[model samples]
Target: MNKVVCLAALAAALGLSACVSSSIPAPEVTMSKVTRGMSQNEVIARVGPPDRMRGQNGNECYQYALGKYGDVPFAVYFRRAAVVASERASCNLSITRATAGPGIVWQASDYAATRR
Candidate 1:
């Protein structure tokens, strides 16, 4: 009986923690400052490195995992070291041929959060 009660309390605490985890906001990307003529290094300095890269050479897609679920990805297309477009992708979708991809970039409920 004591063990069951302790387990129940632990579970409730965990649930509450997850509900409140995102109360701290993510760092915002100053995307408006990123311009077409800037070099890839310049963009990275502002928007940070993307979660994934979809192409090679100076032309490539830089995908940043964002939105509510974090599984939502947004890509900034660059050609010859210049920005072409920046757009959010469909929910739970990728523009690449990857058979599998990463989950939410940050998950409050994951086991890793508890690690020292």
Candidate 2:
């Protein structure tokens, strides 16, 4: 019985660690593994799909807004199915694309959290 309880606790811990909450920095939320030449599907598999996808099928940018006080918005620009570039600033997130900014708009007061 004691062994069973310990195993269950371990499993619960492991499961919770996999979910990256909105409070966590975007880059820390599985973005470090993203690399050039990785297919869009791979990007999705690694970090989960972006909160917002813009542009068309081939040429697109996947944006994940940290929305926290000091987090720099992270975006992966994909061209022809692979990541081509990433921009540090100019981002937005929303319930729908209706109010989403076309690009990241980092304000002067916004600072990238250094440690994160």
Candidate 3:
């Protein structure tokens, strides 16, 4: 009887641990691993098309935004002809249309002069 109780307790603990260990997947954003001077097409290949795109100074710019419940918004900016300039935020939680708000705007020059 003692051995059976111990086994059952161990199984319950293991089950609880398994439940707690499963974590939500991270968000999918364009320009997650972008580099400088990467063409617009390359950025699309990695992160898919942006929610919206704009042109400035003859360069194309893309903006990717993700917002999740109980988490701050995530935004990534890509220059028209360059890789990601900088990540606006660090939130990695999954975002959805229902949770995501307005689109973010990225400027072309901001990424044009970036070294790396």
Candidate 4:
């Protein structure tokens, strides 16, 4: 009976530890594993679900909140369900064509870049 109680306590402790650790996001090293040509499902599996999603059909964009404060925005562009490009920046930007080098626009105090 004593052995059984001890095992139960140990199991409970490990379960609680797992729950606490999972609440924190994975490190940057995990995010770095993401690469071009990876599928949308693959990216989601690596980084978890995206915080924001935009676009439709062939052109799709998914934004994830990163960094210690969750302030850094990471955008991954998908073309035909495959990753074409990924960008990390202070301003949230979305482009229809991930391969295209579009102009970056800046406004006074507020930075308003191209978001589509």
lDDT of 4 by residue, 1-116 (tens): 99999999999999999988875454465468679999989999988898877654535677788876787778788777788877774223336343323343323422222433
| Tens digit per residue, CA lDDT, model 3, 15-109 | 99999898644553333456666666776787667664444332434555544441433344333355444355542222211112234233253
Tell me how far candidate 2 lies from the true structure as C-alpha RMSD in angstroms.
12.1
lDDT of 1 by residue, 1-116 (tens): 99999999999999999998856234244446567677778878877887877544455567777645576566666656677666666212233212122332322421121111
Q: Answer with 3 or 4, whichever has the higher TM-score.
A: 4
Q: Rate the local accuracy (lDDT) of all candidates.
A: 0.57, 0.60, 0.48, 0.67
lDDT (Cα, 0-100) at 61 in candidate 4: 72
Q: What is the TM-score of each predicted model, taking all chains together?
A: 0.48, 0.50, 0.38, 0.57
Task: Give the alpha carbon lDDT tens digit for every residue of 1-116 in model 2.
Answer: 99999999999988887664435544565557778888889988987768777654445567776545545567777656777666554443222122222443333332221111
Sorted by lDDT, highest first, which candidate order results?
4, 2, 1, 3
Which is the better candidate, 3 or 4, if ranked by lDDT?
4
Index of the highest-TM-score prediction? 4
Native-to-model Cα distance after best TM-score fit, residue 23 in candidate 3, in Å: 9.4
Which candidate would rank higher by lDDT, 1 or 2?
A: 2
Q: Which regions of candidate 2 fall more than 4 Å away from where they truly are?
A: 1-29, 67-71, 91-116
- The model with the greater TM-score, 1 or 2, is 2
